[model samples]
Target: MDVFEHIQSAKGPSLFLLPEWQNRCHLLTAGFTGRSGGVSESPYTSLNMGLHVGDMDETVIKNRQLVSDALDWPFEAWTCAEQVHGNRVQRVTEEERGSGRETLANVIKGCDAIITNVPNVLLVSYYADCVPLYFYDPVHHAIALAHAGWKGTVQQIAQETILAMAEAYGSRPQELVAAIGPSIGICCYEVDGPVIGQVTLLLEKLGCSDDSADTMLELSDNGRANLNLKEINRQIMIKAGILPIHIELTQWCTGCRRDLFYSHRMEGGSTGRMASWIGIRER
Candidate 1:
């Protein structure tokens, strides 16, 4: 069964929600946005949530505001970071709430992962084929969002986020719930020599056997390989102590389902980005 449930309402943002999480924790709202329901021109189409993607800042802000309204979350609480595809995790607090809600200038700097125990601070990160990693530690009342491209995945950003939550909020990795959101899957994410080399090194370090590594990276005769980023990140989560049963993996491949998502690789790089958001509301 698909973990990310698509809620297609005439009145709300086109969102793929983690319904299990919402049902488990009523105050929590966690999900990824689709490519509709807002105002933006061609290429960006409608509903582009990223401020850094060269879309009119005002237009992007309006789109974000629309989604916020749909989520019943205040646009003021929508906090974000400037993703650099690195492993750095920033711990968001009350003082830093709403850091990049309106503009990129105030966004948390140089981090791909943002974690917070602060209520009502909605953590968001943009995506256009890159994976969105969601983490929640109900025991600590904490949550996190990590932007994992192949670079961040190679750098083990998933592990970094886990460790950061453990250190900052005393979250036990075994007790944390995780979800791997929509992204370019192996069916469309083909990589060449340089990327293959980096992935090979990481797989070796993970002690993945040749057969298991082949499942993650299927090489072709032309020296390109289809990379399973979602699975790699899932394995990384397991390696970091998250139980297999606690992790949710989505089947929506952005590349395969461009009608429902934005694919930078498929659409030639000049495209808008969807958002992955997680927040714990204040009661």
Candidate 2:
């Protein structure tokens, strides 16, 4: 089943909520944003959640505030990280609540993954075409968000987030529930030789046979291959011990759904960003 439920509303940000997780944990709210229902101009158009992408800072804040209001979360709880396409994971605390919500100046620096057991601190990461990785450990009440572009995927950001959660909150991978949110899919994501080379190395490390690897990275006649990033991240999550049954994978591809999402590659790099967020409300 498609777990990212799209909520069509007349006001505020249009969002995709993870209903299963919310049903399991009443206080938890998690989802991704769409491109409609915001104040930004073209390129950013509307509902742009990224602050560093040349959008008016205040306009970006307004868009973010809309998301917070729609979630009924205080804008003060919106925390973020400056994704550097690396495997570094930052363990957020109460003090880090609301960091980088409005500007890149205070964003969690050089981190692609952010994990926290701290309540009332909403963890957010921006994305455009790249995969948005979600992790939750009900056993420890810990939730995390990771940004996985090809570089981060090759570096195993998913595993890094899992290991960080285990070290910080004693979250066992077996007890963790994960989700791969909207991103580019194999049909719309073609890659060149350099990317194929790195992905080849990672596939070998994952012990994928040529046939299986072909499904994840299929070679084409044009000296390029289509890469299924979402699937690769799902495999990484499983390799890290997250149960297959506990993971939810979304079929919405950013590159394919340009009307509903902002695709950097599809839009030729002049695009806004959607946000993937997860947080436990303050009790």
Q: Where is model 1 more than 4 Å wrong at Cα?
A: none
Worst 10 residues of 2 by lDDT: 5-14
User: What is candidate 2's lDDT per residue for 1-283, written digit by digit as tens?
Assistant: 5789888698767799999999999999999999999999998999999887899999999999989999989999999988888999999998899999977888889999999999999999999899999999888899999999999999999999999999999999999999999999999999999999999999999888888898999999989999999989998998999999999999998998998999999999999999999999766
Q: Write the per-residue lDDT of candidate 1 for residues 1-283, one digit (tens) a residue.
A: 5899988688666899999999999999999999988898988988899888889999999999999999999999999999999999999999999899898889999999999999999999999999999999999999999999999999999999999999999999999999999999999999999999999999998889999999999999999999999999999999999999999999999999989999999999988999999999887
Best model per lDDT: 1
- Whole-model lDDT values for every prediction: 0.95, 0.93
The residue pairs that clash in candidate 1, if any, are none
Query: What local lDDT does model 1 show for residue 50?
Result: 85
Q: Over 4 Å off in model 2, which ranges?
A: none
TM-score of 1: 0.99
**Clashes per candidate (backbone, < 3 Å):** 0, 0
lDDT of 2 at 162: 95
